[model samples]
Target: MRIALAQTEPLWEAKQENFRRAERFLKEAKEQQAELILFPEMSMTGFSMHPEKIGETEEEPETLNYFAKKAVEYGLYIGMGYVEYREPKSYNRYAIISPKGGVLTDYRKIHPFTFGTESVHYTGGDALGFCKIGDWTVSPFICYDLRFPEIFQLASPQVELIVVPANWPEDRVEHFKTLLKARAIENQCYIAGINRVGHARTSVYSGDSMIVDPLGRELAHGGREEELLVADLDLEMVWKYRAAFPAKIDRKPELYRKLADGMQI
Candidate 1:
């Protein structure tokens, strides 16, 4: 499958303008023959904690509908993040839409960035989202979830590709790159991380979007500029490598139960 990461600079609290930009990017991705396109976390409204201003309920998700229309028009799968409001609480969520304008998945972020006080603003998700896309088993995860390897390990057995939409700051870009490659190497699955560029409030993002193959080879990468990074992934390569090496099969889950027993340093 051919994937395109839309490394865009979302205007803070400006949904319409961002939606316009996203449409242009989607058109470009379609022209490039990309089957799927990914945008960064909080795609329309940069990374803002003020959910009251940007959050949308599932019943009235204009942002999601906008992308769904674009997906159908462009004949490509679209994945974008937003703040989801569900009754009394809100969650950091990513939604996937098919080419026919159907909603494929709505994945709430499992791990909120506590250091950034995201936990205070949004609730963490109770479940992971996984779906079969083409020849690959695909999973969608949010920004802070990349720091937790256990979640990746749990999905690794069934997932062939993992997509992360992040609003990571420029200061911690090295950690982002390191963790992305680590996840790909450990799980033997392709990983695509799409981050934003430009400034959001006081924080600045460099947009180090990248696509890594199952073997930890970077197929495509983006720098500080707002652009699209595209790469073609082969599902056969994932199965071939896993069948030959079989590293995940060697994991001793029972022996590692102590990891959940809260051992302290």
Candidate 2:
């Protein structure tokens, strides 16, 4: 499958301007013949603490409607992030829209960025999400969830590709790149990390977006700019690599469970 990573620069609290920018990228991705396109976290609004101001409820769902329309218009499967409001609580959410304008998956950020006080404004998700695109099973995760390898490990056995939509800052850009490759290598699956660029209210992003293969090879990289990085992923490579290495088959789940619960090995 051919995938496009959209490294965008969203204007703070300005959904309209960001929508225009996103549409431009969507057109380009379509022209490039990409089957799927992934956008940065909070694609319409930059990372903002005020969820009440930018959050969209299911009843309202402005952001969701916009992307679904674009998914149909461009004839491409779209993955993007937004803030979801559920009564008193809000969630940082990643959603996948099918080419026919149907919602494929809605994955909330399982690990909120406590260091940035994101937990104060949003609720963490309790479950992992997966969707099927063509012959590939895909899993979607948000930014901070990339640091928690356990979640990725849980999804690895079932998925051939994992996608992370992030507003990861430039200060720790190296960590972002390293973790993407690490997850791909450890799981023997394709990993796509889509990030934003430009300055936001509290931090700056350099858009070090990357797509890594099962062998930890960097297939595509979007360096410090707003652009679309495209790459073709082969599912056969993932199965072949895992079959040869047999690393997942060697895991001692019972021992790991005991260790996680602080029991004697």
Candidate 3:
């Protein structure tokens, strides 16, 4: 499958303007023959801490509807991130829309960026999200979830590809790249890390979006520029690499239980 990453520079808290920009990028991806395309975290809102300004109610999600509409219109699978409003707080959400205009799944962000006060404003998700697109089993995660290897390991057994949409800052750009490669190599699955570029209210993003194979080789990478990185991924590579190396088959789950029990290192 061919995937396109929209390494965008979102207009701060401007949903409509960002939507217009996204539409233009979608058209460009279509011309490149991309089957699926992903956008950065808080795609249209630029990671606003105040949920009231940009988050939409779950009962009537305008951004999700727009993604579905675009998916149907372009005949492309769309993976997008947005803020979902609930009572008392909101959640960072990732929605995958099929080409047929139906939503495949909505994954709430399991880990909120506590350092940025995100956890205080948003509710964390309780479970992992799994879905299928074409011939691949996919799992979607938000920005901070990239730092937790346990979550990635939990999904590794079934997921062929993991998608991380982030608003990671420019100062920590190297950590963003290094972690993405580490996750892909350790889990033996394809990983697509899509991040935003330009300035938000609190920080600047450098847009180090990339698609890394199971062997941690980058298939496509975007620099600091606001653009799309399109690359073809073979679904067979995930299974082929796993079968040849079979690294995951040697895991000792029972022994690792001590880590979860809060045992001293």
Candidate 4:
């Protein structure tokens, strides 16, 4: 499958301007013949702490509706992030929209960025999110979830491709790149990390977006500028690599369970 990573520069809390910018990238991705396109976290609103100001409910999903329309217009699957409001609680959510103009699945960020005060504004999710795109089993995760490998490990056995949408800051971009490759190598699956560029209220994003193969090789990489990166992924490569390595088969889940239970090794 051909995938496009939209490395964008979201205007702070300005959904209309960001939607225009996103549409431009969507057109380019369509022209490139990409089957799926992934955008940065909070693609319409740069990382903002004021969920009360920007959050929308499932009943009133303005941002989700816009992307769903775009997905239908572009004739491709679209993955993007937004703030979800559920009464008094809010969530940092990622939604996958099918070409048929329907949402496949929406994943709430399991690990909110406590360091950035995101937890203060949003509630963490308890469930994993998965969707099927063509012949591939795909999973979606938000930014801080990338730091916690256990969630990725749990999803790895069932997913061939894992997509992470992030507003990861430029200061720790090296960590972002390293973690994406590491997750791909460890899980023997394709990993796509889509990030944003330009300055937000709190920090700057350098946009080190990347697409890594099962063997930790980069298929596509984006620089500091805003751009659309396209790459063709082969699910056969993931199956073949996992078969050759047999790493997942060697996992000692019983021991890990014991550790999780707080038993001495």
Q: What tens digits encode model 2's per-residue C-alpha lDDT throughout 1-265? A: 9999999999998988888878889999999999999998988998888899999988988888999999998899999999997656699999999999999999989988999999889999999999999999999999989999999999999999999999999999999999999999999999999999999987999998999999899999988889999999998988888888999888898899888899655
Full-model lDDT for every candidate: 0.91, 0.93, 0.92, 0.93
* Clash tally, candidates in order: 0, 0, 0, 0
TM-score of each: 0.97, 0.97, 0.97, 0.97
Which stretch of 10 consecutive residues in model 4 shows the poorest summed lDDT? 81-90
The parts of candidate 2 lying over 4 Å away from their true place are 263-265
lDDT of 3 by residue, 1-265 (tens): 9999999999989999889989988999999999989999999988888888788986889999998899999999999988888768799999889999898889999998999999889999999998899888899999999999999999999989899999999899899999999999999999999999988786988888999999999998899889999988888988889999999889987779966787865
Candidate 3 minimal-lDDT segment of 10 residues: 256-265
Clashes, model 2: 0
lDDT value for model 2: 0.93
What clash pairs does model 1 have?
none
Model 1 RMSD vs true structure: 1.3
Candidate 1 per-residue lDDT over residues 137-160, each given as its tens digit: 789999899999999999889889
Q: Which 10-residue span in candidate 1 carries the lowest summed lDDT? A: 256-265
Candidate 4: segments with Cα more than 4 A from true spot: 263-265
At residue 249, give the lDDT of candidate 4: 81
lDDT of 4 by residue, 1-265 (tens): 9999999998899998888878888999999999999999988998988888888976889999999999999999999999997655689999999999999999999998989988888889999999999999999999999999999999999999999999999899999999999999988999999999999886988998999999899999999999999999998988888888898888898899888899655
In model 1, the number of clashes is 0
